[model samples]
Target chain A: MATLSLRDVRKSFAATQVLHGIELEVADGELVVIVGASGCGKSTLLRIVAGLETATSGQVVINNRDVTELEPADRDIAMVFQNYALYPHMSVFGNMAYGLKIRGMDKAEIERRVKAAAEILGIGPLLERKPKQLSGGQRQRVAMGRAIVREPALFLFDEPLSNLDAKLRVQMRAEIRRLQRRLGVTSLFVTHDQVEAMTLGDRLVVMNAGRAAQVAPPMEIFERPADTYVAGFIGSPAMNFIPAVLEDGGASAKLEDGSSIRFADGPRPGPAGRRLTLGLRPEHVEPTNGDGSIPLTVELIEPLGSETVVHGRAAGGMPIVTRLQGAFSGQSLSVHLSPKHLHVFDAETGRRLDS
Target chain B: MSSTALPAAVPMQAERDDALLRATRRRRVMSKIVAHGALILGVLIVAFPIWMTLVGSTHDAATIGRGDVPLLPGSHAIENYATAWNEGGGKSRTTPAALMLWNSLLMALLIAVGKITISILSAYAVVFFRFPLRMAAFWAIFITLMLPVEVRIIPTFQVIVDLSLGNTWAGLIIPLIASATATLLFRQFFLTIPDEFVEAAKIDGAGPLRFLKDVVLPLSLTNIAAMFVILFIYGWNQYLWPLLIINDRSMETIVVGLSKMIGSGDSQNEWNTIMATAVLALLPPVLVVALMQRWFVRGLTETEK
Candidate 1:
């Protein structure tokens, strides 16, 4: 196990800068997932840490050793690729033992490690089968076994489960978590799947446009996102943003329909009349018929077995989606945006504002 | 009531379906007959010459010289083959058919193996390495495809002579070994290998040479087998170049030797021994193609990667 520190990491290609000074610290035995949308450079960051790609400027320290100039082989890391990257001609045992053989390890030791890893992965009977003969999930297990046998200082996973079907993806994701926990290896996982990140990582690094928008535990990122991007990205149906202005000495926000809702928390530290964007998650919006509730003209309704999702527009044509616990058949309803779950952000900058 | 009604309606529909199925089966059988007929006709068309050569090889020289080539094997088969294998057939009878066959076999084996080795390495370098003028080097090799041996025969002959390789095995094999077609084929195959394999190999601590030996070579076995068959045939059938270069009777190849066995006056030629030698020359290439037939088809049609 080892700590990884990417200090002031920056990358540029030709004239376009892809990564603009990313700084991160991954503690030993911590599975830090770098999650983002496609083209956000999450894979690039993982490749840099794997020593597959060199950082244009900065230092990559693994276990307190600067290894920026080292080759991927000398860096002592293992990577599980998205496509499994198993040698098609070799058997499962050969695939797992390749790295050990390359390092000049004894034949008996290689066999022992491969056998142990195969046993742990529950693929003992498939040791002699080529990759083409195995199913997709079995191939994924072999890929993981290849990495496990190396016992490297760090493990790099580049969306290893992305090629599997949805059910297998979920199953393998948990297996990977359990295996990593048992091995106690420091790992950096990169993916464009927020759900995978949320369910698999000890801590999540939400990347936006090559920058770490927020770095925290999954629930913390869901509960208190650092910016509007993270807030909208993490939650299902996404958090809704209603354009408003700070009013009543920053104690309340006045919507465009001339309706005002006081903050349940303390007043935000902003001047009166300041433009603010109020964030409300779909699950947090309650359907109410009481006073001060905004009227919603329902446009669509999706009935998912245990819950219903209502899509509608509020006054001033602001689109809003709310998740209700039970089925509701209505052409129109009123939704109360709770102050306790509101996310306050500055309109000028998408940064979150604290009360 | 519904079950009783269903049986009554089912007979009419079932009869119609049965008629349709019979018609479909009739058409399929008719098509199979036509296909088999065409295939048999094609086989006869292609196999007639080889059959004629085989039948003629079993007859005495007097029967062939009189233009009465036998349709059936005669009792002289053993004698004709023994004469062809032991004694040379020509004006002076200096070079034995066995020696010519041995020379041709060596040349074909050398050329096929040398071409495959050089082309695979060149293709690997062109596809995997980032060197200066890599594309330029590839295009240079590709450009040679247009220049067949006949096109540059004079200059190539002069170079071989200048290098003092004339009438030598090197002169016969080296000029023909640098194959542009095989190199291009291998380059295309290598391009389909995903980048992830390279990255995984790197992470596994395999250097470039190790990666080539462990991964690239094993993956390329089918292509190599396929190329060996084609290159072997190409080398075996070489007539004009071998004739133009080798003046020594000892270095004469089977193709050139077989052609020389025929005289301008038909009566002076030993047609039985010549036919037996002709049959001998066709054996090695046929054996190679037969042995590697599976890999040859798979290499051309399917990609294991």
Candidate 2:
């Protein structure tokens, strides 16, 4: 396993700068996922690390060696592409053995490695079949097997499960995580799916507009995102933002409708009377009929078996969504906002405020 | 009570269904008859000339000379074939049909293979790699499609003579090998290969040449077979180029020999032998097409990548 580091990696295509000074480090045996919307430079960063694209200005160090100028093959890295990219004419065995063969490995060793990888992927029976004959999930497994056979210092995955159906994606996500843990190879996974990033990564680099908005563990990012962009991006159904003003000497946030939420954690890092943005996650809002609850005029209800998501507007016509554990149907509901889960950002800058 | 009521209503619906089925079956049979009739008529119309040639090959020359070409075969088939195979018709340029067939086979095989090799490599370089003036080079090659061999016959003939390649297989084949149509077809096919395959191969430690051998060539098998069939026919039927290049009677192609076998005024030509030689000329190309027809149709329609 190797430790991978990117130092001030910047990329440009003609006049457009796709990656603007990205810095990251993956400890040996760690999985770091780069996640963003399409065209947000996440894939560009992964390609730069894979040596498919040269950084405009930077250094890529892997296992204490600077590999910025090396070809992808010489860099000891293997990549699993989104489409699987299998040679259609070759059997599964051939696809996995191609790299080892090119490296001049003997037939016995190549066969051994391919057989072992196929077994691990539960695709031993499929090794004799062509890629076109396999189901989507099987092809995904073969793609993983091909990468695993290389036994490279690092593994690069570019949305490897994006083409599969939803249930299969979840299954493969766990399989990939388990496989990476067992192999203990440093890996960099890039995807546009936040849930995949959250579930699979040891740590995530949440990218926005060609820059890393936040880099932290998934739960840490979910609980305390560094900025408004990360706050809205990392969680499903997204975090809600409401215009507010800091009152009571930064101890509480007074929203535009005159309702206020007190910070139970402590005094936040903002001046009194300063305009701020208040953030709350959908799952953190509890439906309550008690005092100190915000009234929500319910507009829509989505029943998702175990959880019910309610969409509505609060006072001052600010849209809000609340995900509750049980089902509820009504014209209005009072929801209690936990002060511990409240996020505050400066109105102009959108940077998170710490208590 | 509901079951009894349902059984009574079912008989009426069954009557209607039976009527509809009979009408549909009648229409289907009528269409099938019309289709078979048209196909049989088409086969007869197309096969008439071949039938005439086959029948004439079995008759004596005197029968054909009197302009009473027989509708039935005579007992002269064996004699006519033997004469044509051993000593071709009307004697001015009697390269035996056997030697002519061998010469035609060699030329067609060489030309087809040579053109495919040149075209695939040129197309690969054009589509896969970026170089200075790449599009300019592509457009230049594309412009050659306008200049058929017939248009540049005199200059090409001069070049062949200057090189002193007359009557040689090199002279016969090389001038006809570089085809713009084949090159363009290959270039179009190569462009559709996904970029990811190239990147994956590069990561697998395969250089450009290795990738072409291991991946590109196998993927192009169908296309190559299809091109082989077409180019073989084109090369086999070539009349003007072979006529201009080969002065030696020993190297004359079957097409050229067949035409020369028809003698000028007042010379009696062996019509049966000429007809037999014509049959031999048509066999190799028909076999090539029949053998490769499946891949030819597939390659034209679908790209594996």
Instruction: Please give me the DockQ of candidate 2 compared with the native complex.
Output: 0.67
lDDT tens readout by residue for model 2, B60-149: 899998899788888899988888888887756399999999999999999999999999999999998989999998999899999988
In the order shown, the candidates' Cα RMSDs to the true structure are 3.6, 3.4
Best by DockQ: 1
Superposed model 2: Cα runs more than 4 Å off: A269-273, B1-30, B294-305
lDDT against true structure, model 1 = 0.91
Task: Please give the TM-score that candidate 2 achieves against the real structure.
Answer: 0.93
First chain TM-score for all predictions: 0.98, 0.97
What is the TM-score of model 2 when looking only at chain B?
Answer: 0.89
What is the lDDT, from 0 to 100, of the residue B254 in candidate 1? 93
lDDT tens digits by residue: candidate 1, A1-355? 7999999899888888889889999999999999999999899999998888888999999999999999999998899999999998889999999999999999999999999999999999999999988999999999999999999999999999999999999999999999999999999999888899999999999999979999999999999999999998888888889999999688999999998988888898777899998999999889998989989999999999789999999878999999999888889989999999999999999899988
* CAPRI-style grade of the A/B interface in model 1: medium
The residue pairs found clashing in candidate 1 are: none
